[model samples]
Target: MTSAIPRITRRLVALLCLVAAPAAFADIVIGQVAPFTGPQAVTGKAMRAGAKLWLDEVNARGGIRGQKIKYVFRDDAQKPEETVRLVKEMIEQENPAAMIGTVGTSNLEALKQDGVLEKTRVSMFGAVSGATSIITARNMYPVKASYREEVERLFKQLGEMGRTKVGVVYQDDGLGRDALAGAQASAKTYGITLVAQSGYARNTTEVSNAVAEMVKQAPDVIFLAATTAAAIEFTSRYQAAGGRAGLFGMSIIDVQALLTKLGPDRARGFAFSVVLPTDDRQDREVVREYLRLRQNSKDTELSSRSLEGFIAARALTKAIERTASPTAANITETMDRGFETDVGGHRLTFGKGQTPSRYVDFAVLGNGGRLVR
Candidate 1:
């Protein structure tokens, strides 16, 4: 009987040890919600490619803290309602350590409802700048230059060119409104007047009428604040209407597809603020690495949209690496410490009260649809 009792005790102890052993920690999951299947699908696709490239590289190099990163993409369809639902679902089910690469102002704004960042305590980074509200959130970080900063820089360049009177055309959405507001405010500081301001819906395709209306004003410069597709259509029609005013576009329009669609003759002399460094082979180590990655990628023709995604992912990765743990509060604290990273030759910094990407790059559409900085 004593021998049987001793064997039973040993078996029970072994079972308890097995039950108490810690489970292996899985890879860190980063959730990305963007307009993957809507009007901005091109941008979404580019962003996804860039992110994937970065993730592949990171994994190849043994991911941060010896843990792999798993990026889960959610399609918001560029709709505010869908964005809200998708974000909620991701937070509840996946419980990702952080969220990155949310595109568009409306979608970002929708994600801001009910102090979601504070409640979930998840770090959100890499929002394509549209509204200042997103970056202002303590927990949210922006990887791109703000529309306000871009507009201010454009206005400064216009002022230098002696082009004072500017006309503005924007979609009547949160993005356009924020850009127009920024332009208007910056114009005041530069002693420039926005001669005409026109608004249109995103669903509207024919902007010839709007172009004509803007041309009638005869402003020295036209500031376009619309999506890439609308910007292309508007620019084509505006030029076709024989409007000679210099055209300036925001980051939203600073895409390769628009330049390709408008062609060199139409796109020439067109200037826009670029949040990321263009595909300049001689820029920085980061750009070189990015190009190398793209060359190895099956998909050629890497666009600025994808570059934005790559920048965002890198920023998030840096934050995660610096963080003590994958917890939201620790990640936010690490980001708030203002670590610097090189996005191509451009420098990006994040901290409290400091907007990301203080310096903005200006690109001119040159011959052969090339972007010259």
Candidate 2:
């Protein structure tokens, strides 16, 4: 009788609390996996902040069909094994309608191999990779230009700028391999011989040897196929040694963040391929909206990476709004309908015989760390 009386009292308290909770948004949820506590944590934080900014605005507008957007996040630390386990755990337990912000190619590939994507029916949205995973998977979506496109455009852009001798410093991994494939094709097409090429293991700061090799060939533009941090280290050492290569980086390289790390002396005069327009670009209403939202953010500092995250979240939200409920099937169908959507001038449309975005832009860092458009 004593136990029964206490249980009855607990039930009454739960009912009262439920009655008091907000009802306007209490159903929708987004799940994310990222390198929140690793070498990539800086970028992970930026991406999360950007996603939260858009989500907060959406919820303030009463959410999608009055269902509040709740986010569940797990840190993969950019490891493939950990990513596989965590993704499996979420699919079996969390019941998220769609998974967004999963970082790295291996992480996403691990999830697909675990068979959790189909088992849970949780579509992947706005993942960080522009590799083959995006197009090969039935439910995954890409927000940035592919490495292939980035490399090809880099060659064309360099050619346009009258730069023929290109050198590549790439990390030895899937990311680098994909980038190299594209660069080789571009070199063949452009009829330009690669001035020099070298590969280093990921996370290694010992690039003096590679830098020396590249300096001998005197590449007009040094295309970086390495990770962001690795690229910074190489560029820093290379430039300090009086290497005059026009330091070029891929879309995956965060040029702004790289500048912040290297300071004005090392970062100035560097150019990088980007998938999004510059922050100051205001020709598109979508661009203006992003600037406004970013200005209203608490951090006030934004990067191309963060802006891409914002655009991706905003794009997915539009698709979710078309669904009757936050179910994977409904979300997938809505997204596949090929509806024209402008993500701050990064247009995304996919329907019968259509595809997702493949736009590429360019930016160069000038004196005092200013991004010269």
Candidate 3:
């Protein structure tokens, strides 16, 4: 009888070991792809900093379900082809539980087409705003408001001020077309007229001809929808051309960069919608963490891209905690129900039937190139 008892106890121990094996080896991996080098390098640096802050916080909290999260970051250089390559590499190599905080629409669009999210059963969170095409897929979750929303908001404000004639300058791409369509639609609703519209090719720093054409129309306001470098050059030259029309911009343009390039005097009174609050450094923990991270960061200036990255990481952390599993399928399921996180004062939400972020706060360029909410 004693020998029988020892054999029974040994069997029980073996069962316990088998039950604990999966849990012992569990790990959660999250991927981030951004332009670590290129024209948008400043934006990418800020995003990396913001994502690191959130990941550090999550790790300090004992990690998700006792499994530490490994953040695998890759630089896509802001090119769609490079982004696709990097994302494919991450999936093949790291097999991250999910990809979070992809920094551009072009990259997100490519990933969507590649069916990365569907194959991995993971959500792409915190992507930069563009047309609704990216998030139309069930797997892609965007954390920032669309360019369409920005155009609508700007047009609504202009209509309130009784500005009926508007001019638009955009880059010739999917993003630019989205902005132009939104602006045109909004203007039509308000009975405002679109006096002129022009486009420049992507990565073209010179927009003199496009700006000159739009200025020739003499509209009440000129909408500048382009990359930071192009927008800066257009605004500088547009003002130089003695065009007094009020300058408006989409969320893609780095407000700080605009101010830096145009200076406070030239940038004053310029209006744009912000996905996150810049001036509010209140009792928010995220804000405190961001400020701390910024202090140590070589890039001192804050932009919408930085806030987008921080917010995306927060959402990813929430999804991890909610799932409490280190599997991609489980985490993606949690994300479909959506999650909420604070981007400064603004609350960012993502969920079913919600293709893009609806949270947007309006801000104007204040003195000394500051974004005042």
Candidate 4:
């Protein structure tokens, strides 16, 4: 009976260890790659901040399913080759349970060329890029409207505003190609043709030739589809040359960044398509929640990019809430289950093969760099 008591005590201790073992191993690692150290660092910082808004709250509530969400961030310097290298390193070294918030579509193509996603089979959620390939690619998911949807919205708004003679100044890359393709389709639907279209090299603000083309075309509206620096350079030079054309930018262009580049008055009336609603609109459940969260947030930039990241992180948590293991394989399996949760005012759906969200809206940069409906 004394020997039996020791066995019983050992059994009890073993059972206790099993019960308490979860706490020691309760953590989910989420990996992200962006241009954290380059010119695009502002957008990178915004994406990181927006994601943390959701992550911090989830972690504070004992984490989703008792596992704390830990993030591993790497800077790709907005370079495609470097993105491929870092992503491979992340998979082998960091071994993140999931990947989220990649920045550039050029980087996306590079990642695909490297065949990392195919080998790892990890789902990448919510890239800040407007490139259509993110949604069209296998095992990749996007929570925002494609450039086509944003352009569709932009063309409709331009029609309403009685603007015509559309022209395009695009970056000479995959992202600009996507925007240009969408613009052509949207122009057809809007019953017009582009007056002039031009392309400039990526990563350069030298839009002199493009600006000269704009000056020669004298388009009533310019569909600016370049990066922040390129777009700002084109617009600044165009306006300086006394070219008076409506600046209509895609979701990829940072309107706030442009506003800071040009004064508020110069940036005024410049509009862009966005995937999220304005913060002041309480009509939207998502905007309402975003505003409430921003009120308490130390990182409140309130740009569309930030909102996109927050929405993506919220969706990530929704999937993590159900997965028992929360590894890369397990998380990918959760995506297959078809998430139907309504985040903020947005209804997100991700299934085997489907576009996640086509939500797009247009906003004008108002007097104080505010997004006006």
lDDT of 1 by residue, 73-183 (tens): 888878878877888899888878888877777777777765676777787877776478776766677777778888888888888888999999998888889898998
TM-score of each: 0.89, 0.87, 0.87, 0.91
The list of candidate 3 runs beyond 4 A from truth reads 1-27, 279-285, 292-304, 338-346
Clashes of 1: 0
Q: By TM-score, how accurate is candidate 1?
A: 0.89
Give residue 156's lDDT in candidate 3 (0 to 100). Answer: 88
- Whole-model lDDT for model 1 versus the true structure? 0.78
Question: Lowest lDDT 10-mer window, candidate 3?
Answer: 296-305
Best-first order by TM-score: 4, 1, 2, 3
- Residues 1-373, candidate 2: write the lDDT tens digits: 7879989999999888878864443667788878888666656666777787788888889888778888788888888788878877776677677888877776777777777776666777777777755555666776766788778888887777778888898877667777888899999888767878889875455577779989888888888887677888898889888899788887777777788889987798888887766567788776787778887777743566777677778888978877776777678777655587776667886543234667887888999988786
Name the candidate that leads on lDDT: 4
TM-score of 4: 0.91
Q: Which residue pairs show backbone clashes in model 1?
A: none
Which regions of candidate 1 fall more than 4 Å away from where they truly are?
A: 1-24, 203-208, 336-338, 341-345
- Model 4 misplacement above 4 A: 1-24, 160-162, 300-304
Of the two candidates 2 and 4, the one with more favorable TM-score, higher being better, is 4
Error of 2 at 94 (Å): 2.0
